[model samples]
Target: MQSVADGSQSSEVPNVLGDFALHLSAQRGLSAHTVRAYTSDLEQLFLFAQGQGVESYAEMELSTLRGWLAEMASRQLSRSTVARRGAAARTFFEWAARTGRIEQDPAARLASPRQHKVLPTVLAVNSAATLMDAARDLAVEGGPADLRVWACVELIYATGARVGEIVDLDVRDVDLDQRSVRVLGKGDRERIVPFGVPAAAALRAWLERGRPALATWSTADALFVGQRGQRWGQRQVRDAVHRLSAIAGVDDVAPHDLRHSAATHLLQGGSDLRTVQEVLGHATLATTQRYTHVSAERLRSSYQLAHPRA
Candidate 1:
């Protein structure tokens, strides 16, 4: 835990935090990333309480939690960040009270600032075609690595999956005949997403020729492998997307951009919000509605460009 105060006043905080982390993982089935984030948030809260002379989990109070959030706000953090931290505090205190680590939940009434709904940047349909064409060209000339990159981009655009979901996929998770993949999302939720023909073609090539050339003993069941022939990580796929964007003469974009583009394009093509929500693995229909705003912005831009009424 990062400390604002010099000395450790109580060992009980760390013990309780460990238990809470296990609870988040084993009982709640939260993804590893979320578990780590909540743990880090609680660590900062514990340290902040220590600095204010509150020594242990049982000693934590609503005022100390409020002060911690106030201090973060004073630092001019984004509303989303501040809100997430506040939510983390609320979760922690509620859990503590439930587990007998605290006598009462301090954050029962905690409220986070509503996160701003900023429109995501998505590639134009023509620009996406340009990117895919460039990816295909590279795949034809280059080796297994090129095919892997090509398949990754195509599948992401087709399914609008998160980068973490793409990298976590095993070969068995994909069904070539059905043109679908089963993604295990946050909280271990699973959904089947259908991809288009372009994605299917790229995947078939990767599975047959590309992956075989790259496979090693350590590769196991992983769909995508790095140069070392092990499971490719999210960071590595992100780096690949960056490089692909550069070479294709497009705006620098991450795998997330492909996801955004896919969602927006689907909406532009008249897909319903509920269908997009299921494909994107969003927990709420509201989360998928953001792409409709993107589509509206694009339409307005086109109208403004072409309309002659002044």
Candidate 2:
């Protein structure tokens, strides 16, 4: 561990952080990305504590945790970011206390600023159709690369999966006959997500024409591949989505917007909350409830537009 005060390395802090990271991975089953985030948050907290002349985890106190949060706020970090850091601190202290690294959990009563729930941007139905149409035109005009882009967009709209999950897909993960794909979600949880006919057609075309052309010895079992015959990257997928959205005259839409649109569309199409939760592989129903708010807002807008009331 590096001292937060003068940038000198420490002995015990690093060892404890390593143990905590192992606990998160082996026991909690958090994804590597999530683990990395937590690790970074704790490291920052430790650095802040050290800067305040606190040297070890045992010296960590509620006031020290609060001071770290205050510093983050003083720097004008977003409420969500502060809240996340607070959560990381809380979890780390709890684990430390449980494992006898600390006599008591200092962060037990730690409070974080309430994060404002910002509604995610979603495409209108016609706009989504236009985006798909544009992608389809590209597929028809270009060769393998075009087909792969189209398939990726279609699957994203159909399944509401994260970009990470999309790029991690292997050939065996998709099942054309079942119209479903096995998605490895956060925490390495697996779920089968169904796709529409358009997505299915696009996938089949990519598998037959696009992927075959791109596949090399290095490609292995990747369902989607880049031009150089490697697994598709998240950046590439994001770029494709942005390009397609721009071509369709819908500016500023990212891959996550498509997922938001899918969830809102599902709710507007009469899908239940629990079902949507399952489909999106959300760990908690509360995480899925945001879409309901989106649906309600849309309904209010539609009512205001169409009704004769003044």
Cα lDDT tens digits, model 1, 1-310, are: 3352445445566677788889999998888988889888887888787789876767777788889989998999999988988988888888988977778998998777898888887998888998998899999999999999999999999999999999999999999999999999988889999999999999999998899988788877999998888899999999998999999999988999999999999988989999999999998998888887888887898899999971
Candidate 2 ranges with C-alpha deviation above 4 Å: 1-8, 308-310
Worst 10 residues of 2 by lDDT: 1-10
Candidate 1 TM-score versus the reference = 0.92
Model 1 Cα shift for residue 103 (angstroms)? 3.4
Instruction: Return the top candidate by TM-score.
Output: 2
TM-score of each: 0.92, 0.96
Task: Encode model 2's per-residue lDDT on 1-310: one tens digit a residue.
Answer: 4664455686677677789999999998888887889988988998888788887878888999999999999999999999999999998989999988889999999999999989999999889889998999999999998999999999999999988999999999999999999999987789999999999999999998889889998878999999999999999999989888878797568888999999999998889999999899999999999998888888899899999991
Q: How many clashes would you count in candidate 2?
A: 0
The local lDDT score (0 to 100) that residue 285 gets in candidate 1 is: 97
